[model samples]
Structure formats: structure tokens, C-alpha cells
Target: MPIAFSANLGFLFTEYALPDAVRAASRAGFKAVELHWPYATPAADLRAALNETGLPVLGLNTVRGDLDKGEFGLAALPGRETAARAAIDEAIAYARAIGAQNVHVMAGRAEGETAERTFADNLAYACTAADAHGIGILIEPLNARDVPGYFLTDIAHAARIIDRVGAPNLRIMADCYHMQIVGGDLLTRLTHHLPKIGHIQFAAVPDRTEPDHGEIDFSWLLKALADAGYDRPFGAEYKPCGRTEDGLGWLKAF
Candidate 1:
């Protein structure tokens, strides 16, 4: 069977408005679309775009707290519980309006026991809020190189946190590009965490571009995912090397 794919609007169509990006992804033959922080766009506009394109939204990220200060996320930041929970609330509300399936709760730069406790607490709060709306909560383990000092940098750590929280709706957002850089044991991790995986995404390793130029053998990787029983559409979360639509040969190649 052919694998279905979801376009990541943040990376794929930066030149276009968020709503227009939705239409562009549909035109490119994507089964669905995801987003980064899309708070600037009115939820109604985006929902109309999705309705027009007939594409369901996969997920979107919580806002990166104070980007000017280099805060990528707030969940793991020890002293920002209020901001973290508020961000979670906002993401949950926005996601609900757009009919998204998941929310990626980012764990910002931090460490030590305090950070761990804060992250778990925030995730618990997020999961509880999302569960009511029938939306899932996702935590992605960003790599050290690209996301230096990030709290959730290892899958094992993320899984442990999920287990600690013990929320049925909580799961991992496995982005293969980050995982490959973190470590090369993708298949083993995927199998081990299959029960906990909320979503899957891919891009070129070393350089976050279209999968066609990557070190990863996406054809093999995709087959492995399918063989492992993950039937949901995989997320195409990669920066384009050129015009987003022009760089879509890999969609057919895959």
C-alpha cells in the first residue's frame, strides 16, 4: 500500500500565508497538514482552508515562549509553570478549532530534577486538558546539536516521563531527523516505543531539507514503519531546498 503523508506547513510553505499553505499542501497531494505556532492566523480562516482542501490537520506545536530570549518551550522551564500551562491551553484551544488530532508540547532548555518535575507536571496538565477534547498530547525528543540544552533530548527519558504521568492519551512524537542525529538505532526505538508513538515525521539527516537528499533511506524506513503497524499518515516536516512545490519529487519517489 502507498504510504500517506502530511505536510508540515511551517517548513513546507513559508512563503505563503497559513491558510494558503493548507491549499498548497492539498494541491501537492498530501493527505493532511501540521503546523508550528499558527496563533497569528484566525482559527476560523485556517479551519475554512482545511475544509476547502478537504484535509484533516495532524497536529501543531505549542508556542515557543519568548523567542527573543531563546526560549524554545516553556514546559521544561522550572519557573514558568503559569506560562507553560497557558501555552498548553492556547494550543489545545487552537487545535480544537482546527480539528487537529495532536499537540506537541515542547520541553524547553533546562535540566536537573526541578526541570523534570516541571515538565512532567506541565505534560500532565496538557494531557488532562487535551483528553477532554479527545485530542492527544505529544512530546518530541529534540536532538542536542540542533536544540542544545533541551530538556527532552532522549526518547528513553520522554518514555519514562510519559510512564510517570501515566496518562493514556500521552505519546511520543517521533521525528526521525532528530532521532537519527541523537542516535542511529531508529528501528529498535520505534519497535520499543510503538505502543507510545503518537506520530511520526521525517526529513534529511544532518541537513533539515527534503528527504530526497538525506542519509536516511526513507523508502526502507517507511516500509519498516508500515511493517511495524503504524497506519497513520507520516508527517513530512522538512525545510525545502527551493520552492516548496518544486521540491516535491520525493513524494512520488517515495
Candidate 2:
């Protein structure tokens, strides 16, 4: 399976609007693009942008509590159960119109209690709801350095939760940057857990910049994905080093 790039509109349009981001991604030769939060922008506008650009949406996260107030995660275990459910429901409805099959559910930070058990329970609940919508739910782990005290900071732990949830619709959304920050052998882990992976997002390790700026050899990683039978679009979820278009010079070779 040859790898196809999917731009994350969140990064490209961080300084611009969704419409311009879609156009930029299409111009960069990306076949698909994803957003961070659909509710922040109107669904009609997003739909129109996708229509104009002919780019499919790969995935999006469920709505978080507050984007500005530092609340940016969905599955926060037992304490935030009510808010998490509401957000997941909202994201499912959004996905219906945006044509997305997977939604990243952020795991809440552990509160120094029985964190693991609470996380497992929440994951099961989320997976059940996602299965009802005929969509998959992805558990994305942030690095401990960036998100201190976060309960699901380890992909291996996330994998365990998915196994405990025991639902085919629940899986891990493997972000390469976080994986590297957490000090894991990505190739080995990705190969070992390929069956439980729902989607893939990428950023250059160290700088969190475009692939060309980082030391990560994405070509080899992509080839590994191909050999491992991953036939989905690889999400280009990197921060632009400069102008978004200036960072696309390497895609032709990819």
C-alpha cells in the first residue's frame, strides 16, 4: 500500500481560516484533511471548503470543554463523565455530515485515585457509544512533558484499555511525535499493535515541525506502514516551519 498524505487543517489553518486551509492542503497534493474542532467553525463552511477542494476529512476530535480555558480533552475518566458523553454525542453528529469515521477522545488527567480503573470504565462507555454511530473511537495519548499528570500518556497503556474495552470500534490513534517524546521504539510498537490502531498522525520529532525539518525519516516509516498492511492516509499533523505551502516541497518525493 503506497502511502497517501492527509493534511491536518488545524495546523495549516492555525493562522488562517478553515476554507483557506482546505485550499492550501489540496494545493499541496493532500487527498484528505482533518480539523481539531468542527463546532468552532460552522459545518456548512467546512462542507463547502471540502467541496471546493475535493479533499476528504480523515478524522476529528470530539468537542472539548473549552478551547481557550485549557480544557482540550474528551475522555477524562469518571469525574467528567457528563461532559465527555455530551461531547462524544456532538462529535458523532458532526461526523455524519463531515464524512469522518474516527474521532479522537482525549483521556482526562489522572486524579491520584484509582486512575487506571476509571479510565478503563470511561473507555468502555465511549466505545459503546461510538459503535452505535457506526464509527470508531480513538484514544490519543499526550506526552507527560506536555501534559503533566495525564492518565493516558502511554500508548501501551492505551492499548491495554482498548483491550479491556473489548470493542472492535475502540482503538489507539498513534501520533508519532508523542510516541517519540515518551521514549518508545515506534517501529516495533507500531508493528506489534497494528491490529489495534485506528488511525495515524505524524509530526517531526524534537521540533514538532514539518517532516523535512526533523530528523525522522518518514519514508522508512511509511514503507514500514505499507509492509505492515496499513492502507490508509497518513495524517500530516505537523506545525508549519514557515508558510504552509513552503513546507510541501518534500511531498513530491513522498
Compare the candidates by TM-score and give the number of the best one: 1
Model 2: lDDT of residue 115: 61
For model 1 the TM-score comes to 0.98
TM-score of each: 0.98, 0.91
Backbone clash count for every predicted candidate, in the order shown:
0, 1
What residue pairs are clashing in model 2?
Answer: 76-108
Per-residue C-alpha lDDT of model 1 across residues 1-254, encoded as one tens digit per residue? 88999999989988999999999899999999999999999999999999999999989999999989999999999889999999999999999999999999999999999999999999999999999999999999999999888999888888999999999999999999999999878888887888999899999987899898768998888889889999999999998989999999999988
Error of 2 at 40 (Å): 2.0
For residues 206-248, could you state the per-residue lDDT of candidate 2 as single tens digits? 8888776565788788778878877788888888888888778
